[model samples]
Target: MYRYDEFDRDFVSARVAQFRDQVERRLSGDISEDAFKPLRLMNGVYLQLHAYMLRVAIPYGTLSSKQMRMLAHIARKYDRGYGHFTTRQNIQYNWPKLGDIPDILEDLAGVEMHAIQTSGNCIRNVTADHFAGAAADEVADPRPYAEILRQWSSLHPEFSFLPRKFKIAVTAAENDRAAIQVHDIGLQLKKNDEGQIGFAVWIGGGQGRTPMIAKKIKDFLPEADLLSYVTAIMRVYNLHGRRDNKYKARIKILVHETGTEELAAQIEAEWAHLRDGELRLPDADVARITDYFAAPDLPARAEGWAELAAWKKADSGFASWVTQNVRPHRHPDYGMVTISLKPIGGIPGDASDAQMDAVADLAEQYSADEIRVTHEQNLVLPHVALADLEPLYRALQAEGLATANSGLVTDIIACPGLDYCALANARSIPVAQEISERFGDQARQEEIGDLKIKISGCINACGHHHVGHIGILGVEKKGAELYQITLGGSADENTSIGEIVGRGFEPEKVTDAIETIVSTYLSGRSGTDEAFIDYYRRVGAAPFKEALYGDKAEAA
Candidate 1:
């Protein structure tokens, strides 16, 4: 919810003008593609398989109704009729014309949104928990710190072009919904016994060909030293991180090679020089940013729970949808509403222009004119009153946004794979659609429980396949597409990378394989009380592996 000031507006406007000129130069043949590639990438433009893709950042996943409406406008006027919400809490226009991207950037700028740092080897968007301000269990709002970090890192002279792309996530909730453990720098906002807010810092966590859970570089980092500490860490990584090989250039790889102890020492040594310097955040600046994210006013008791309960009792579908999509908010009379982008047999996170418009309207009417884009590839109306739940649900249902599958099996997270991404090996969206359709039954999905299935086209792990309870990685084998399945991966506070269960399956067999795994889990689970993740942890991957390979092994 942070608004742009004069300086911020001028910065973005200048960058837009610069990029506009660069684009024109490229189009006019004044510069070749090789010369224009970095410039376009710096502006969040990418030449995809068929056309160009434009990624727009939703900082800390916060947006206003005005911003959402602007995004819908871009989807309608510029690119295809729909846009894809990515795992990073960003939106991607998969079919934008190279010539029209400047216009798109200008449109975004009008709404205080931009494409800068959404791509290329720099500190990308600073993400936080979607439930940051509204979650009942949050320690504090993490957005203020995230915004501070965003401002500090944005176009920083020293760290502008790192060896590889970097990501940072902050979460104040006891539950790590932000998946901080798997980011380049994961900050878990915490309070000490003295009630002072600080962060438990984790470094080097990432998922790609080489997946890692970040190490705790600092058990507790004071709030005041945030920028300084982050700077120190970046300096260490920038200097020591590999540039010779793109594959091993990430901070995760550097951490692995240098060892956590040496890395921590280096960071600490660097911090000694930078601590209490110009980067040390002042209390006044922090307060100003915090004021921008102040919680909305809500009545202590809104008269709607009784009627809502009655409605739920009368309508099973409504009850189911509420149970799945409605999350507990800090305010008792309000609920956080998750708008599912994953409709059955459709792309996982694609929202049409009309859907976007409807969601924007709903956010303005029911919520406090604010919206949140979740890392799970969903949109959230974070502060809806209980009285407004029925109307909001009705509105969302009419818009095709009410899928009633948040955290369910059908609520899949998949990247734009072979269909759009040039780096992809196989089609991910189709696989996600097939899986969603396979488990599309409401009864079956509920029976399956809170199962997370993440699909990535390649090892880059854009879909967060490494942390999914059931992770699917599509790979190219010979001339055919093979899907590899990993079990027991989780992205929560207790983060763990999944293990491959067996040999890869052909694309056609993937759904069946997933079904077999689920079936095996249901049969072998301690009881219905035991969740898939708990059961998988207790029983290990043996049962699932046996279920998958039993017949094949015998035949061999």
Candidate 2:
């Protein structure tokens, strides 16, 4: 993780002091709610149904042990006993008193963290692959680039207060774990013909009332011009992005209206002015940032196949965990373990203070003193030895962080629906819990194979429902909470938005409808060789739609 510098330190302290005064003003009645709204949002404080919620930025979802322990302290001292890790890979405290927010900010600053750009219509936290540095197939570490982007966008005078919230994601791996295609700006790091590292840049992608896969603006931007390239893209959007209507304010809308070719042309023109300007990255700067991300020291090769396979066979529970929870690390004998937050019916991304503390401890003891948060809202010990699996699992199980359902159907991704955000039509977490209970059996979940079931409370697509193999969006029909199901959607190298099956289902009917769809896939799919997404793409949504609604149940 990049340590905060003096300038960064001072900026946060000043911002904290500023926000403290604003909170005082809001509380003391010097300003009306409307007057204080933007100020609070900029600080990541949301006035929710029952209390104020504060979301703290964990840039690129990287954390030092000291930082994780600090978050645990904050959770224990302030709000509820827990914090919710989000799909965006940030953490949120559900209830923080208005007055205590300043103190909380100060506490976060103590560990070199803050809530700046966590919210508001500015560029938000830049999420990257959880297994970033450690992923075996990665061409390069993406976080240094993500950090560069953070510096470039943070309080940036030009791009701040854009059409709507801007999100950018980067991934070095070809697997697309970061869902880069669904972000406002998605950069996939790649090696060009000359073998110099650059980016396959995609812009204007987003998931909201309108979902769009980012169109490629540049096939290969040179390594030196990364910042300038990004600036050019943002500049183009800021100048022409819709601000006349909130619904159509995102860069996605602009991409739709202007067409990608014209948008690319505009970005190129903008790049002409800035590509090699002062904002252009020098090799030395890249080297400096890259220095922060040097790989953890790994021991010489030792293949422990018998020991690992024994652990796998002796403990099928741990085997299931290894199957889903563990991912290959670049180091031959090391692996990354995902601590699933979706434990049965609980909130998807939430972790108690004690759990956070334990995770930090485990990271320090069994692995390097580093932790990572995933876009799927899970935690990762990025460099755990294969030999350390049993002990780590035991420790994680002790902390209630061992769920073992990393990418299964029940491991659903849900937004902070109507319960927290006033914008949502229905509550997404409860819906996720209900679905989890509906398919609670371990055997049943294993039977279903790898499936991504995501839910967003509203059309804003906060939960990324549009990309789930089986996507569920909770909507308002007259006054009731109903669900619209979309099938065959994906956010991978070949990204595509889901197709809606038919009429929406009431909350009660949703679980069964999903079961029906899954059952249809199981029965009709070409053997167990087919994943849900592969089957959907091969046969299309018509078969699933017929199963979900039947012939008579088809239309709205």
C-alpha RMSD of each candidate structure in angstroms: 1.1, 1.2
Q: List the residue pairs that clash in candidate 1.
A: none
Worst 10 residues of 1 by lDDT: 547-556
Q: Please give, for residues 461-496, the per-residue lDDT of candidate 2 as tens digits.
A: 889899999899999999999999998888888898
Put down candidate 1 lDDT per residue, 388-478, tens digits, no spaces: 8888888888888888999999999999999999999999998999999999999999988999999999999898999999999999999
Model 2 residue 43 distance off true place after TM-score fit, in angstroms: 1.0
The local lDDT score (0 to 100) that residue 145 gets in candidate 1 is 95
Which one is best on lDDT? Answer: 1
lDDT of residue 49 for candidate 2: 78
